[model samples]
Target: MRIAIFGKQFDPAFDEYCLALFRHLSLTGAGICIYKPFYEFVSGIPSIKLNPDSVFKDHADLPECDMLFSIGGDGTFLDAVTIVRDRPIPIVGINSGRLGFLADVSKDELPSALNDIFEGHYKVRQLDLLKLDTHIPAFGELDFALNEFAVAKRDSSSMITIHANLNGDYLNSYWADGLIIATATGSTAYSLSVGGPIMHPASKNLIINPIAPHNLTVRPLVVPNDFDLTLRVESRGGSYLVSLDSRSCILEESIELKIRKADFSVSVIERNGKTFYSTLRSKLMWGADRRN
Candidate 1:
């Protein structure tokens, strides 16, 4: 078996775990490749010897792996998406940070989790993602988001107007702080903070939520995921923010972004007993009503 590890390498916990994970895999005979960021920061520290398992400067240096280990919080997992976009790689996240909605594995489960993998005791799950296309000036198609695509303001004092067309038909204009076009996988993210509903990851819905809309009557909208949606935001600023999952960009006012489902997904590996409800109950304290 082959495995890949991706994350920020400056932290002490992560550096220790990298050695432990590598050593654990050493016994199992599974080939391991540590991402470059690991050694880039840990350089000159006492060298950690990796036998059958090894460290790599880039993805190309390592033998193709079966699993990709994300060794940080949710943001680290998000960063991993760029490394394996559209590839059929399975990711296992180790939560080394707070509010780990995406990073499922805890610090205590270290070597044992790899043991589970060697025993074939894990499950593979298909996750959904959003795709973005653009014809606006200085923009192109084929961008994607495992979480969300949001158009937000670059300045503090002004609002942006987002003109949206759903399924090739005109929809109401959104004049607000910004707008969010989130996938079912993203409903819990920024979209949720802006009055969007939390959706099941497998649900066939797209969430369109406003960021501080000028009109109170304008509510968050959910549409069938298959619909063709074109969203364009017009603003006068140095640069407007266009985010694809964890990756973000700043563009001029002449650009537009069209969003829909992606052709491929990040195959996140999960343990047998893990469920969305369990994450919600434990991590988010969902439905913890005080008035009950």
Candidate 2:
């Protein structure tokens, strides 16, 4: 079996766990490849010397691997998605930081996780992604977001007016700092922070959440994933920022944005005992109360 590891620069606190992961994987005799940047980051560390089968700097250099391991936090996991774009390879996340929603596995669980993978004690789950459409491409050919697609005012103080339409029918005009269209995978991300309801990962729904809306009555709405949504933003600065997970770009107010479910979905590796509900309870501290 072949596994590709990807990560970005992380705090020194996570260096040991990262090194341990590499050492354990290398010992398994599985074909190992590391992203060039991550390999360079650990080059100076005496404890972590990796003679990987391949060192990849870009997606084109990524060889066919059975699985890809994303090291670091959720941001690194999102970055891993960009490389595994439209690929069938299942990506697993190894958390080396706090609050790892996407990077579900902890350093303590690394050995068991690997054991599960090697012993075929894992399943591949498909995650839905939101695709962006615009006249001029902002995020290149890979315009899909695993978490969400958000549009917000560029300036800090001002709220933007986002005209939204669902299936060519007027939905509502949002007067807020920003708006988020999140997949079920993203319901726990930016949307949840702003009072959006959490949807199960298998749900065929999308969340339309407003960020600090002028009217309190305008709450987050859930819609079918199949509907095509259109958005036009008007900001005082004449520009707005649109983010696809960790990637973002500024766009002119005149640019119209369209969002729909991506034709493809990313596969995530779910080891035994790591279910959606279990992750929610552990990560979000769901139902944890001293009084209870």
Query: CA lDDT, every prediction?
Result: 0.77, 0.91
Residue 264 lDDT in model 1? 82
| Model 2, span 26-120: residue lDDT tens | 78888988899888888877777788898898778899999999988888999999999889999999888788888999888888888898899
For candidate 1, which ten residues in a row score worst on lDDT? 134-143
Off by over 4 Å in 1: 13-16, 42-48, 51-63, 136-142, 287-292
lDDT of 1 by residue, 1-292 (tens): 8888777754564667667766677777777677776645545346456443567654346447788888788888887776766677889988876677788777777777777777888888888788888765323333777778888998888888889999889998998888888888789889888779999888988898999998999999999888878877788674588877766778877776778888887898877667888878867887789975
Model 2 TM-score (2 dp): 0.96
**Consecutive 10-residue window with the lowest summed lDDT within model 2:** 41-50
What lDDT score is found at residue 180 in candidate 2? 95
Candidate 2 segments exceeding 4 Å error:
290-292
